[model samples]
Target: MESETVTKRKTSNETNKKTDSLDDEEEIGLKAKMTLINGVTVIVGAYCYAELGTMIKKSGADYAYIMETFGPFLAFIRLWIECMIVRPCSQAIVALTFSVYVLKPFFPDCQPPDDAARILAFCCICTLTFVNCWDVKWATAVQDIFTYAKLLALFVIIAAGLYFLLNELQDPVKNLPRAIAISCTLVTVVYFFTNVAFYTILSPEEVLGSEAVAVTFADRCFGLFAWTIPVFVALSTFGAVNGILLTSSRLFYAGACEGQMPEILTMIQIHRLTPTPAVLIMALLSMLYLMSSNIFALINYVGFATWLSIGAAVLCLPWLRWKQPDLQRPIKVNLLFPIFYLLATLFVVIVPMIASPVETGYGCLMILSSIPVYAVCVAWKNKPKWFNKSLSVMTTILQKLLMVLGKSNKPAQV
Candidate 1:
């Protein structure tokens, strides 16, 4: 009973994992070239991230890859947009979903509690922030355990699903049109990490258009409880939240550490050995986002924005290669790779306009609107007095909060 809980909870059905049975059938039925394209897309993405990471390593600055490739102005703009808007919106969506899935299993009617979900989401963000403030080591230690447990949970799910499917169905179900759809579905599942973390079940509405294959099969074959799925879903999504929180906070702290942003954001708790102020700031922004937006609506708005940001960064690969040909690259993906990659990404960004114009337009507008704000906010020349003063005050507040929570309040160093 306990083992099968997660399979019942997440309805979108990537957990369906659809087996290699589906993929083998799809390959035989669909044109090999089509499957080849989707398969290569995944490979290219993996290669691209590796190339980007190498650039970051060789450059030795957190933002150096962008700065060296695109110049300081573009670098500053990317920093402002990412830190101020993109990461917060993303983190909020993750937090909200974490709350929804965590609360969902108890409601067997499939109707999750919206008010409770919202409150819990808000509290989850705050609690994570509070724990990190109290002690970074303790918070990370807890997160590490959850991270492993998440992997174990996923292993349990896939293993169970596969065991049942393999034992019952020796032969693959081959259907031509279904092949194309499943292929696309598989690609989407692998492409978007957030899919793991949903309002409407995309697999049912968009991919399978019915009850998930795994769900129906599990019911008929194993007669498992309907409640096993959400727990594992929650476990994985919670791990994702922890990852997002830690990585995003580090971006801001490192930005401040490099003098790219206000130094107050750089405040580290000596006792806790964490960036307490930056963590709190991100949590507060995440809380604000949760208060304001609907989960699906936020996902829609962020989809375009995130892909745009990612595309911009990915496009930098060719620049880094061209400008610094002499630079030691751990892995070099050719110029043509990024060229094709950019076109592929352009299609991804443009598709939203055809499918959902209003949401995608608003998203693009939100990203574009950052330009003038970037102009005003980034002091490429001299530090503004008010900016410095604000940092001093915010730093003191963050430092005092750290002390009040535990350690003696000596002047906190940024």
Candidate 2:
């Protein structure tokens, strides 16, 4: 009887172990599916926005028109805030953030690295510079190829995620909701802030900066796959960074052409037809930015300004729709889209403002500094025709205000 009982117990233990293994596999599959869904959502959203912006420009009103309608001072402030301060600072912050994560394991106290690590860091910077200065077209093509690969990789990851989530279907409802809430909150905040950092500091040459999405994923998956992940991470991030550099430089080049900035900036090399000068200038400035310890603080300031501009743009959507009913919108933002964008923008603006007093103070000063620069460009140079129209509108508004006060019929008026 004792021998029989021992055998039955051993069999039951083996069955339980097999069941647990199956559950683990199912959980992983579910998690991958969820991740894929998230990835697709992002790709679709980005494509829509990019296409929409291009369509708007093609319709009639270009950047100048937008500037004229929005106040030139305000527009100039926005441009300066984005191009000069925000973009460069944000890049430095991202590099710093990644450096922190990469180096943390080696140094428990998070102290500066010793000579060996510093040497490695220097080598990385040199490599980054080489990548930036290489043939623009080739770089762009490479980036495109990698971007598609990254997307595919993300889909695979998502599939894995979904598989894992599905396997956990028997989990309690409260646990699931809590997990979902935490996951969404983390993804939204991290994704949004990281992009915010990218948009603020990104230039043509500096593109995606030090850390790519692949690098981020690799870091997360380090324990599971070890060295394999690092190789994939390097390839994925390098491609992403290259793409970012191309897009950013183009934005600056376009801005320069709009007469909102120096016309010299619009100049491109005839041979390459690339904005080599702008790229060089932006890269040098970004490198200088890297030396500063206060880089992240500066990024916070840029974040505030960037989000404010984005919020203003989103708010203007409703106004634009009502004011220019006939304006062709190839892709209209859904009502809910604008609302959520606004709320997100508002949160970004408020959070940094409340958190960093010095940054807020410096941001205000930077904005004021743009006024004199805009004045000189408008007064002496061949200003865009819209500048006159804007001035005329302002004069009309001031005159109307005076007339209203004058008609009040007080003794002081007599």
Candidate 3:
């Protein structure tokens, strides 16, 4: 009887061990699957935005609308700021934070104080900026390639999502104009203001903002399939930043090399083929701004500038249409498209002014802030000669002093 009992016990133990092994294998498999899904989703999302841009361009609304309302100078300024400063900074902060946040729940003990988190966020920003500035070649090779892939992937994801939302779900409200407007508006505000605060405040040693959407998504969807979404989002945005940095660096380099900026900005490290000085300068300025009080206000100020610029761009459409009517248009807007674009631009322009007192007091502040910068750049360039040269010189001196004392660099310079 005792021998029989021993044999049964051994058999039971073996079975339990096998079951445990199987469970482990299943867990690993699920994780792998989730990672893949997450990556794909991010790629698709990015792709959707790319497609949207293409659509906007093709519709011919961007140029025609902007030229008509804001004039070329303002339109150009708007494009320059959005492309060089606002979008890049915002995207970088969001991407990096979101990526880190996605891993947070997995390592619960890693959570730090808000201040500490913000500091770490600043470090991340500095690190990435340093990498981009350290060597143009290295930055170009690693960052740009990854960014292209990311953009392609995101475009795919977004297109797929739109399709799914519109077709697969077959929701009646998918095509509703009001719904589209609301959704776009929300996304625009989130995208615009979040980065300003992120660059201006959260880059320091303190954590101010909430964990990113990607991380939030990860926590909400603990399971494999669900967790994948956030992972993909992180990947997509990370790559997007890579691309933004590449373009931005080149723009700065070109400007500086052409004598449009301070001579120090043109310095390039021979070994890394990077703009070490430029990167360091930019990182310092961004950090100082971030560490200062009322970072949110600065962010709003930046947002106001960005929106005004975009509005100007929208207004340019009519001028471009008239001046370059014979120019080849890759994308053509319908008769109604310009009207729609103008209306949207008007709404964007007016809403902020109306909401400024209650929300940010940002409407005129941003315009005032840009005046000096624009004046200086114009004087330095001296091509069109729109603004006063003396004012430009004064503003430039003040800006330089602020940068020197505060260790801050403009995104445009970066």
Question: How would you encode candidate 1's per-residue C-alpha lDDT over 1-414 as one tens digit per residue?
Answer: 754766566542664566544654453334334445756665565567566765476332325556767866667666766776677778788777777776655554454677888898787777777777787676777688777766565454455545544665675123423443566556544423222211011222323432222233223333456344555556656666666667666677556544566565665666667777677778887777887646656777777766676677777787666677787766667677777777887988888889988777777777677677656556444657877677667767865766422133355333
**Candidate 3 on 1-414: residue-level lDDT in tens?**
999999999999999988965665455455445544434333333332232343343322333234334554453354345434465445445544544554555554454345554565566666577668665666667665655555443443344334433563374123333344455554443433333222222222222334443343234323455445445665555555545555544445444443344544545544555655556655555555455344345555556656565545544444556665665444444434544555655665576666665434543643455556656664445444334444456545644543431123332231
- In terms of lDDT, which candidate is stronger, 1 or 3? 1
lDDT of each: 0.61, 0.52, 0.48
Question: What TM-score does prediction 3 earn?
Answer: 0.52
Per candidate, the number of residue pairs that clash is: 6, 33, 56
Error of 2 at 63 (Å): 5.0
Give me the displacement of residue 39 in model 1, in angstroms. Answer: 6.3
Candidate 2 yields a Cα-based lDDT of 0.52
Question: What TM-score should be assigned to candidate 2?
Answer: 0.59
State how far residue 262 of model 1 sits from its true place (Å): 1.2
Per-model TM against the reference? 0.73, 0.59, 0.52
Q: Where does the lowest 10-residue lDDT sum fall in candidate 2? A: 405-414
- RMSD in angstroms, all models? 11.2, 15.2, 14.8
2 or 3, greater by lDDT: 2
